[model samples]
Target: MMRVGIDIGGTKTQAVALADSGEIAASVTLPTMRGEDAVLATTTSSVVALAATAGRELGEFSSIGIGIPGHVDRVGGRVRNAVNLGVRSLELGPALRERFGIPVEIDNDVTAAAAGAAHLMSLSGTVAFLNLGTGLAAGIVVDGVAWRGQAGAAGEIGHLPVDPHGLECPCGQRGCLETIASGAGLRRAWPAGGAHPGRGLVRAMESGDADARRAFEGLVSGAAGCVRILALSIDPQTIVIGGGLSRLGEPLRQALGATLREWSGTSPFIADLKLPERVQFLPENTPAAAVGAALVSRT
Candidate 1:
């Protein structure tokens, strides 16, 4: 059976029809509109258009899944307090399931991405998937299933209290890791503050830009802290990086690896073992969260 997956982001929404073995039969993209109704309408229109393009009908799809932008109550099928979508406590699964006449799922986008990463790296006993974009988050997979923790707040490393007295985060915390390492954080780190790739600032560091280098150094410091913490706790066999910054290729990997090397020293938690050689580089990366949303049925 075909599955329709939709991913709603801050600037765009994407939907894909997935068949066996990850073949994409149909796909759609729509500019994210300003309101909830507009977002749904735009998505439906795109689905219809894609159906026409494929010479089929949307009714052929067996299930629909939506990867939403906030903490998701997966069991309740609700999107809880999405700041980007201007939505709070929206019952996306019920609404869409009722409308589409099929099972519908609403899950956090990062969770979806993590699932995709896990499937892509099938050798995993345990795995970590990290997305560094406009925001930062991660997903954990163990024995091929996501571990979402009791509060459905797993992989929320951003709010993990990296600095007790550093800076106040919009998430109402002092010096959360996201406040120091995300795209917004990198942008804020710039003194000139003109326009730069918030995600690519690490590469900008290599270019010998003094301010950019300093900013990225700070990012490495925070990132090292994150890696160390996760390494001690999760002990993942593979760690995959997705999102805007992962496109930097080897430079980003090497720099981050260097930091990891430093952080690994003299720590009984790490014990001089090398990090797994499982960092994947998907050249033409999919918006995995969108594709993973589509894969909910398979999961």
Candidate 2:
């Protein structure tokens, strides 16, 4: 049986139908609507539309899954603190299950993406997916299963305190990794404020702007810190980096490699682990979260 997966983000919602053979049979993207009710309505409609687009009926789907941007109570099928979605508390899973009369699963978007990465990469053993999107987070998968931790906060690496005197984070903390390493962090750290500060900073740095170079250096250092933390803690088989900043591509990986080299030279343990070589990039068009949601429906 095919499965329906939905990835709900702040700006847009994506739906995909995964055939029994693990192929994407159909997919659709739509602007995310505002308000709790509208968002729920849109999600249901989008999944049905994807199924139809795949030339299949809703009854053909065995399960439905959704990746939401918030703290999810997997046991209770509820979500909270999803500020971008303008939802404080939502019983999304039960609502969708009732609407479609099928089993439904809900999880953090990044966690779902990690599952997708593991599937896409065909990785085994332990793997960590470092998401450098608007926020920073890491998703851990062990032997093909997502490890959500004791409280579903397992992969919240962004909130890890990295600096004692760094900028304050929306999570009511200072020096969180997100403030230094994420795309949003890079934009906020830019010396010149603008509509697209991160891109502007990168451009300026490429054009030989000293200040932009310094800013990027700091951002690169933060990213390295994230990798080091993941490496020392989980020692996963590989680290898959994805998200919006992934567009930076080689430049980003080069920065990460340089930092890892510096640390490896200073510490024998770092050199022995060879963490830099384990880092890899996700494909440009991979719908990690949506595909992951479909994969998780069975679990």
- Which has the greatest lDDT? 2
- The CA lDDT at 238 in model 2 is 87
Off by over 4 Å in 2: 191-196, 209-211
Cα lDDT of candidate 1 equals 0.71
Cα displacement (angstroms), candidate 1, residue 132, comes to 1.0
Worst 10 residues of 1 by lDDT: 276-285
Best by TM-score: 2
Candidate 2 residue-wise lDDT at 161:
89
